[model samples]
Every structure is written in structure tokens, then in C-alpha cells.
Target: MKAETVRTTLTIPRELLEATDKAVLEGKAKSRNDFVVQALRRELAAQKREEIDAALAEMASDPDYQAEVLKLEVEFATAQWEALQLGETPK
Candidate 1:
């Protein structure tokens, strides 16, 4: 399936545009359009990850969530310790 695309004009620094063109000539990208699309996708993905990290940080600070996480960590450690005492080799 082909993705829907739009035609638009952008004003970028001359040096940056030249670098994109060079990528095409160097066979790093099939064309200027491909380079720009890949660049935009990377930037968008990074932004999304930043947003997710921020949200997770906020959640981590919540007292209820913190307590639950702490409880799980303690249980995990206890289980590992018990297993070791039983002469079980952990993978």
C-alpha cells in the first residue's frame, strides 16, 4: 500500500538543502524527497518518545504508582533470593 503524501514547499538553509542533495548523489537516499521524508519521520519519532518519557516520569512520581512499583520490586527480589537458596540456577 502507498502512503498518502502532500505537495508542499519548504524554506531550509542552503547548506542543509545541499547536504540532502549530496545524500541522494551518494546513494544514501533515492531522492531529495526520500531524504526529507526519512528525516521528518526520525524527528517525529523522537518527539513522540520524549512525550512518552515525560508522561512516564509524571506517572512514576505518583504515590500510588510508586508504592505498587516498590511492592513488585520487593517481590521480584525475594523470589530470586528464594530460588538461589534452593540451588536453582537462574537463566
Candidate 2:
């Protein structure tokens, strides 16, 4: 499936543009547009991962959430033991 795209202009530095052209020539990417799109996608994914990590850290520090996690761990311990008894790896 094709994604919708917006056309725009960028003013990349000379050295970077040279490198980008080299990469495209070497088939690292199909074109400057594809290179830019891939780079932007990677950066956006990293940013989202950072946001998720921060949210998880906040949740880990919350007393109620921590207690609930511990409660679930305790609840699952018996299940893990049963799996071990059945010769499974207990995950």
C-alpha cells in the first residue's frame, strides 16, 4: 500500500548532500526523498520509544501500580511453579 505524502523543500548542507548522493548511488536508498523519509521514520520511532520509556518509568514509580504489579507476580508464581512441574520452561 502507498502512504500519502507531502512534497516540501529542504536546505541540506553541502557535505551531507554529497554523502546522501553517494549513498543513493551505492543503492543505500532509491533517492534523496527515500533517504530523508527513512531517516525521519527512524527518528520518529526513536522519539516514540523514548516517550514510552518515560511513561513506563513513571508507572513503575507509582506506589499503587507497583503494588499491583507485585500482586500479579505473586498470583502468577503458582502458575509458573505448576508449569515447572509439567516440565515446561516456565517462560
Top TM-score prediction, candidate number: 2
Over 4 Å off in model 2, which ranges?
Answer: 88-91
C-alpha RMSD values across all candidates: 3.2, 3.1
Model 1 TM-score is 0.74
lDDT of each: 0.93, 0.94
TM-score attained by model 2: 0.82
**What does candidate 1's lDDT look like per residue over 19-85, in tens digits?**
9999999999999999999999999999999999999999988999999988999879988898788
What lDDT tens digits, residue by residue, belong to model 2 across residues 5-76? 898999989999999999999999999999999999999999999999999999989999999999999999
- TM-scores of the models, in the order given: 0.74, 0.82
Clashes of 2: 0
